[model samples]
Target chain A: MLSIKNISKIYKGSNKGISNLSLELHQGDICAFIGANGAGKTTTIKSIVGIHPFDKGEVTLFGTNLQANPAHFKSMIGYSPDTPALYPNMTGKAYLELIASLYEIDEGERNKNLAYLLKELTFETAVHELISSYSHGMKQRLVLISLLMHNPKLIILDEPFVGLDPNATRFLIDEMKSRASEGVIILYSTHVLEVAEKVCNKLVIFHKGEVVVNDTMEHILQKASLDEIFRDVTSDD
Target chain B: MTKLTLLFLFRLQNQLQLANLNSSNKDVRRHAFYTISGYIVAFLMFLGYVLFISIDLNIDNNIQAFFVLISSILFWAFGIWDILSGPDDLIKSKDRDFIFSLPLKTWQAKLLPLFSKYLIHIGLTFIVLMFGYLVTIAYIDHFFLAILFVLVLSLIIPLLSTNVTFLLAWVVRHVLSIIKWRNHVTESIITLGLFVAPLIYLIRSSASVDYKEWFIQASILRYPLNEINSFSFMQHIILLIGITAVTTSLVILLLTAFHHLVSSQNAVQSKKRRTNAIWHTHIPVTALLLKEFKLYFSSLTYVSNTILTPVAMIALNICILVGVIPNLHSFSYDVAGFTITAQHLFTFIMFTCVMLTTTTSCSLSFEGRRIWIMLTAPVSLIKIAASKMAVNILLFLPGIVLTAVVYAAIFQVRMLDLITIVALLFFSLLLISIVGFFINLHFPSYTWNNDMEVVKQSKATIITAIISMITIPAIIAVVYTGNLYLLLLIMGIEIAAIIVLLQKISCNNMMLN
Candidate 1:
């Protein structure tokens, strides 16, 4: 569903963001992209989502290059960053409507999706209030609603469970499985090994801006527990 | 006490340490340079005033008194302003959780941050006022006594102002919490009352020259400080002590009451939920414009500050219409011996009202961390920039058009000349908007803790103000010379510049700070 080919991004002078990083995802795949701190997981995700321009190589979403038509390409993919980057003055409903309009979603579909997400997240009472007054978990839920409102084919979330409560986290894991079962590809980066091990169908471990492990959950479990493998792979020499 | 001292030192370092901001960040460096340069310029201006006073010491006593009186009034104004917005800087910040989590008492948590923030403001007042006193006293016969008097006077005024302001804020907050209406409405009303009260006083006082004269005479600074006898000197000291002691007692009483009145439950709880139907525009740009309006009107600071210039313009026009202030016109002679009456001086002044609204300059920075929404969205960058510019122009256009019509009717301007002036105002507005947005695009500061920082103190805002200081005069000259073709040519150039800037902004993919 999504492809990143030979992408490279370097910082000002000394630091490296990503170097010749490549990744591919197929339909019905829930890939957990694991990495240590500063392992370039975010850099690669931002590059693929067209938030950061890569120095070399291309990102394609559903056979269309992001560089060729960034807007159209982005419409097919929903990305939620690690932090909730939202307009505090806007109400949750207004924000979701804005995302819908940006994707040119029809009013009927937009309303349906909005109602469903608000119901699913139990955010009906807070939808009318300004987002600045929302708690951290509420803001995260609103961002998730915005991501899912358009029903994008590819979902990319960065640390989605950071501020979520246990109930919300369970709902999110179940939702991801449901979305993947419908042939939607989901890629998320996380530090929680247990959650990833339980939920993700595929594991992609990253070390020093390069992929160290790319295999199915079954294959990885045969070698060692995901936690043991992640620690062993990412620990320093 | 130790924690208080540590917090004060930490805050001092946070404010004054240049190394805290990365030198490699272009926007940070530019903001630091511009802010420093602004201070330097203000210092130079103050030094010029000091030199002027030094040249003439005959009125030295009056000058010293005047400086002290002015300093007191200025400190009072700063105190009121701090009370309105300063609570958030100390009490309701991101660091509050971390600060309160440490081993500290409730009073320490409240008073330490308050004093640390207030120290910088009071310190500035002390330096400026004491410098004036030192310059005055260095030439006096009783230098030591003068120095002692100046020190006491400086300390007293700031202390009184601080305590009074805190008391006033506490009273207002308590009253607001007891009221029934939503928090924002009550706060907005109070904000408007505080802002309009001074203007109302100025207008009422401006009517009588005798009242103004009496005010000047009544100022303590007008007294002859050099001719003070022992009795009067003792009386002055007694009066100062009495005022300070009374104010301190009141503050202490109020502080105890305020601490009890204010609990976690008394925190500002905004329950205002917008229930109006959500309106969406057909065009994308219009949607963006609507979003801009939503952002602008939601904040009391933006509405209060943005409306000030237009209100002033309206008042000036009314004054001209009622013959309170005579409309200004000047005559210019061309090389061909043709006399031209430049009656559009008022138009220039009124058109310059757009300068008061720095919406375009701060719009991008106002986006803050959410700029990634624009960066990652399918929307074109030019569309984003144009929407911001369009909103600002649309905001100011109605006022400009209405005022232009009023000027045309009052001055009996010819059709062609009115069109020329209107066109001039339109082009100038567009030019300024584009320039302001372009500067913001290059030097955006997204990590601002307060919206006013971007609105008032951003490098883009100062740069835009400086540009207006030059361009307003230049445009007036172009109109003063009655050169229509030259105005047209400048308009063309401005249009071209805007187009080039928009192109550059859209095409470039620079690193996002």
Candidate 2:
């Protein structure tokens, strides 16, 4: 289980940040965080992944506190940022291998996972080229492969579908569903409400750095479409 | 505003990061202030050094013409080095597609980057020429003539240098286009040449020639400086007009070639598929070390800036051993009342080289926006910092060992003296590596537009350099006290304390803004 309790993060010299944001995801739960721009989606994800520190809250992964045991806590999570920022000088293969080493995956397992992911993502041939030559979609696919090769317990992706093709996006949704079935908790933020409404089991809508709705996706969608729901909840802000 | 003016303003603002200086956030504003202040301090120090050198030249023999000749040679060498090191930014900017998409003429787009480059060169040349003006006034005692000379030289020098650099870049790019694997081959060849040329020049000059006399007599700037010193007003005007005409023609030629270069750059070559490659895994720290090494060598700017000092140390050691330079064993200098030997000077140079050649100062900032990888990984911050320092050590270790062996062979001192010297050097190396890493941790900048900003201009780099400069003399003084063992013990304890402190800091503050 992943639990974030009353986490608050305010940027220095600015009032724009997540405030008293709280959420929880049990095993086998796929949660979608939907929000407008600057609605604090990325901030909350970053805090949970231990990339940004929260001012007043506690985050724990399966009873392991992030502040007390960061290495172990981070070991159980895989994170992909909204935009993939990769080393241009490194070949795709080298970058993936480096990630695998950092996550301490065995060599045989790493090679097997990489082979499967590369072929499934349609990036087998271009993996030998330098990342500087890769298109945006290719870079996104590489980031996805790196995140999945380690087989973490909790997976977090921020805007992972922006640059992906339709086929890759479908593969990603299917992969999330299959992994969730194996008791891996998945959390991702997106502006694509239609896809989120179809794929996610749980829905969390953020409005002005505060969570306005946290419930099952089915419960929220029974009233109106996600598009209308998001507009109605965030209209005041 | 005209399109060209708007483009120039955009590039200038990006290069200077002016928006950050005017940011609404207090922390951002403060950080920008400190960084800009650091640059101002560095510039002033450079200007002061040039002025002092000019004054010294005057005192020696009133050789103001020699100073002008030397400065011109420096300007020329820098122009050539600039071209040989990297691609012309005008032709290869990252925002090429966006800028070209705008409603603008091709000539306006091409002229923007060239104008930016000119601004930088003009700023640098102005500093050097200010010293030239002062020297001229001291020698000729004519303010108006000195002003005329400075004005004319400033206008013509940057124009000439920029043209020459563009022409050379065009020629080199065309030559590299024909080679297979151009990027890798070009970087390696240029890096090798940059490293080797100075060594050969120093060795040859030390072995055979009186360098100062040869330089003054053989330099192409001698006649120009003489003509200016004679205050031949019409001749100066003619020379300026001639250089202007040539540079204008060169600019036209470059503008015509711009489209062809841009199109050729877009032509992609097919790469061979490596389908059956074996994958290797290592411990996380070793993996990080390998990554750091790749990053250090991948860019010519990084390698050339950090590696040159260590290479100079090795070259100097070879020179001393081969008797091309003075024999350090028998030489001694009486400083104040203490007698310092050539061996001391040799050790001092080695220590200074180690201090100057640290890649740790810029390694963290060099990651730029990709620092998210390090932050999100399961590895501890200590491990990441260690990998950076380890690369610095590995780079310096070979040169350090070579110098130690040469020192032992040349001095033939007792075993205890040799042990003391080696211990001092090793501890100093550890000290600098840790200090550099720690300093960078506090002053990291991940928003740099180019490697030069982080590697050469960032506050972390400047602070690390200042600390190294201060430590070099202090270490030398401690060694001069005949208590090398005491100094070694102190340095070891200091390193231990810093490591403990760094671990604490890293654990508490791992997130970068």
Best by lDDT: 2
Model 1 misplacement above 4 A: A13-16, B17-73, B76-87, B90-94, B138-141, B157-224, B227-269, B272-283, B298-307, B319-345, B509-513
Q: Model 1, range A60-151, lDDT digits (tens) per residue?
A: 98898988877788888888889887888788777766666667777777778777888888888788887888898999999888888888
Per-residue lDDT tens digits for candidate 2, residues B214-242, read: 44443324443335546464565677559
Output DockQ, candidate 1. Answer: 0.50
Q: Which ten residues in a row have the lowest lDDT in candidate 2 chain A?
A: A106-115
The best candidate in terms of TM-score: 2
Number of clashing residue pairs in every model?
0, 0
In angstroms, how far off is B214's CA in candidate 1? 11
How would you class the docking of model 1? medium
RMSD of each: 4.7, 3.6
lDDT of 2 by residue, A135-157 (tens): 88899999999999988899999
lDDT of each: 0.70, 0.76
